[model samples]
Structures are given as structure tokens and as C-alpha cells.
Target: MWNSQSIVQQQQRLAHVLAIVQDLKALSMLPLLTNLDLIQEIQTISTATRPFIPSPTNGLSLSTELF
Candidate 1:
């Protein structure tokens, strides 16, 4: 009685093996995920914010610095 189901013994085992392979495939992308996160964190940290302060133009000039 070597039917297909009997040969495989249990379909659950096959399903489990497929699920484990899928998990391994996902683990293969771990480095890519970490790289993207590191890049985003670096960009966030290195951002420089300059406050908007109006330059004084009310009689003070750059020529005065030479004197």
C-alpha cells in the first residue's frame, strides 16, 4: 500500500519544511534591513539645522570689517 500519502508519511512535515525554508529566506534579508536602518539613523543624526536669523543690514556693512 505505497500510496502518495503513505510515502510522504505526513503532509504536516512537508508543510513544516516549507515554512522553515521561508523563514530562512527572510533571514537572508537581515543584513539589508540593518543597512537601511543604519543609513536612516546616520542621515537623521548628521542633519544640520541652521536657525533663521536675519542679517543686520541697518547701517552695518562688510566694508567696516576692513577698517
Candidate 2:
């Protein structure tokens, strides 16, 4: 869990990024590629910090009961 100060800083960073996205929206009219490209870029950044996600087990888990 994030501390309050860390959460606040993250929210501030998100606001800054959202402002940038809003600014970018004005420059392009091709709707699909812009968002897709941004998503790919964010994914690349995340993959650098974390392992690639595993495939899901077709909605089944080995654990039959919650503890």
C-alpha cells in the first residue's frame, strides 16, 4: 500500500501526464493509432520494470478455497 505522500505524488504525476495527452489530442485526428501507440509505449516502460505477465489458466485456479 502506498503512503499518503507517495499516492499524492503519483496523482500529481498522472495529472501532468493527462495534461500532456490532452495537448496531444489537438495535434491529430487519426483516433486509433494515437492511443494504441501511447499504450504500447507505456507497456514498454512497464516491461522494463516487471516481468511479462503469465498466461491465465482458463478461469481456473489450483486453490479451491480461500484461506
lDDT of 1 by residue, 1-67 (tens): 5789775766778889999999999778767767668655444544433222224865221222221
What digit string (tens of lDDT, one per residue) describes model 2 on residues 21-59?
998885574565576686576567656665435348653
What stretches of model 2 exceed 4 Å from their correct place?
29-67
- C-alpha TM-scores of all predictions: 0.40, 0.40
How much lDDT does candidate 2 score? 0.65
